[model samples]
Structures are given as structure tokens and as C-alpha cells.
Target: MLNRVKRFADKTPFSLTTPNPQEYTLFNQAILYGVLIEPYFTKIHIKHLHAIIIDGYKLFLSLLVGIVNELYGKLVNSGKEQLIWVTKEMIDVSATRIDSLLVCLMRQIVGGDFSNGNLWLCFELVSLCLSKWDCLLQEKPVVLTSALYTFLRLLADHCRVSNNLKPMMLRQMEIEFFVKMLRDQFQLCLKIGRDLFHVPF
Candidate 1:
């Protein structure tokens, strides 16, 4: 299974900064972020679970987050890194795809079905994205604003529920930070205009 996973990872054609157009797709990204991570859940040792798997899983999660961070940066950043020109369609699909994947991963990680380690990974992933909000604002406002809407929606949904799931669900301070960032981004959009995010902020 590990060999198969490694092969899959090696053959994964979904690169954000690649020059090849054929490799770009949400389906490929889903395979990377979703399917690639699934095997670990079942393959973990039953007895020496934490000793064998926890750290590796955490690292894998971190890698996923970092890939996404870079993906966003590559999309919105100037064309210095690309050998070929990026298209509008590429930008549109790449940004929206990441947003959707992150939301889906968030749901999977936070649900009771996953282990506590995976659950906490949700916070790490969210923080990774939110930490880049300023950069996203400058480089890819549309993507950033779309992300803000998704996050606000998630926050609203979380609030409506009674289950806090201590240590897994976000703390009040974290919630405040995210809210503040969203509000500030919304205000920035107002000054910048609807053209920034493609929607009225």
C-alpha cells in the first residue's frame, strides 16, 4: 500500500505552477488532497498507533497545507515563476478548486469519524490559509474574497451547532481572529471595489 501510495504521489500530475496545461484540473487536486490521504487512516498500526503513525500523518497534513498555500501563491503571484502563460480559466478553476477542497477537507477532518490528530489538523490548515490572507488580497483578491465567504459560511454553520468538541473545534480567540480578518478583508474590498473579488463585498 505504501508503495502504491508513493507511486501515486510520484505520478500525480497536479502541479499548480507547472507549465503544462493538461495537468491542471480539480479532479487531480482532489486525488492529491483527498485520495492520497485516505490510505493512512486504515494503514495505521493498531497497537503502536501514535508511535508509528501520528507524526507521519501530521507531516502529511502539513504537506497538504503547504501545497495549497503555494498553489494559491502561484496562481495569484506574478508570472515570474511560469514558463508558459496562465489562462483566465486556469486561474478560475485553480482558485475555486482549492477553496472547495479545503472546505471538504475541513469537514472530513473535524467530523467525529476521524481521529483527534486529524481533527486538529483542520485548525492548522485553516490557519495556514488565513495567514496568507494579506498576500491573497494583494495577489488574488477574487480567490481571497471567495475564501472569505466560504469561511464565514463555515463559521456560521459551526455557531449554529451546540457541539464545540473541545480541543478540536476552534477556540474563541481563534474565532475572533478569523472574524477580524474577514471583516478587514470585506472592508478592503469595499475600498478596492467589486472588481477585486468579482462580488460585492
Candidate 2:
């Protein structure tokens, strides 16, 4: 079935199905989270929440990988390749957004935002940071800086929620040991002269 669909799409000219890229991306992301991820986001189970966070972080990292591919100029150029790239990118971002949506879900489940829920908050924070992976890769200082600011606030909120969350999360958050990763991105922004304000990408 997938092969049949791919073959049909392959035969159609890009012009026939073309849409505004940004709008396409937005719609795709929304559908992924709203339809697919929402099913597994039940907060009654911390395991589900944990899974959401892990999936979100993975999605964010996927963006970083995509940016890397884009940087190396590996952007898909046609048919099957382009279709694969688009699908992968949308899935990555959708996974991340669903992770973020869980934030509001957690709030609903917990009866309020738990400031000390560092694990959830920080996971979201890192997602935001990596969300700017394009800006970072394209050397867009201003956008990266803005991402950093948002990341800081998310981290701070997590800190306010619960101390135990961090400690418990820490043992598992080993991959995120570089807690201040955003600071590195910030320095890069300053070094580049934050002059344009517009993301270069």
C-alpha cells in the first residue's frame, strides 16, 4: 500500500501538489501531535509522561540531525528522496510538539504546573533549544538568543516545580549533562554580532 502511494506521488509533478512550505510544515506538525501523539499522552501514568518527554527530546535531536544534513547540503532533491525527507522532518517536529503539548497536559493532570517538575520542564526546555537547531546551524544569532531566553524560563519553571524531579531525572538525563548548552549557542550569537536580528535561515 505504501509503495502504491509512493508511486502515485512520484508520478505527479511537484507543481501539482505544491503548497507554501511553511504552511505545509505547520499543518504537518499540528496533525502529528494532535492526531498521533495525543493518544499516548495520558498523564495518569508518569510512564506515559516520561515517554512523552523522551519522545520530545528525540524529536528535537532529530531536528539537529536534519539541520546537519541540510548544512552538508544533503537536502533531498526529488521524488522518493524528497518525500522521504519531508516525512522524516515532519515526524521529528511532530514528536517534539506532542512532547510540548504534554506540558499543558501535565498541568491538567497535576491540577497545576508543578515548578519542581524539573524533568518535564527541562525536557521541554531542551526541546525548545533544539527547536532552533535550524537557526543555530544557519548561524542565526538573534533567533538562537531568543531560543535561549525561552529555554531559560522553561528551566527556571522546572526548578520551581520540585527538587526531587531533577534528582530523579538527573540519573536518567545523563545525555543532557551539558545543562547549559544554550549558553554556548548564546556566545556564538554574540560572536556573530547579533546585528541582523533576523534569523539567517
Predicted model with the maximum lDDT? 1
Encode model 2's per-residue lDDT on 1-201: one tens digit a residue.
Answer: 334433323332223333464433332233222222233321222232222342343443344344333432332223222222333343334444332232222222122244444344344434443554554345333444443434333334344444465533532332242234434444654543444242211
TM-score of 2: 0.31
Best-matching candidate per TM-score: 1
Tens-digit lDDT track of model 1 for 1-201: 445445434443322343232222222333333332443422221112222232223333343455544543343222211201111212322332344335434443434323445434445545645665565556555555444444444454455556657432654424654566546765644543444343211
TM-score, structure 1 vs. true? 0.36
Q: Name every residue pair that clashes in candidate 2.
A: 114-161, 115-160, 115-161, 116-160, 116-161, 116-162, 117-162
What CA RMSD would candidate 2 show? Answer: 15.4
| Candidate 2 structure lDDT | 0.36
RMSD of each: 14.4, 15.4
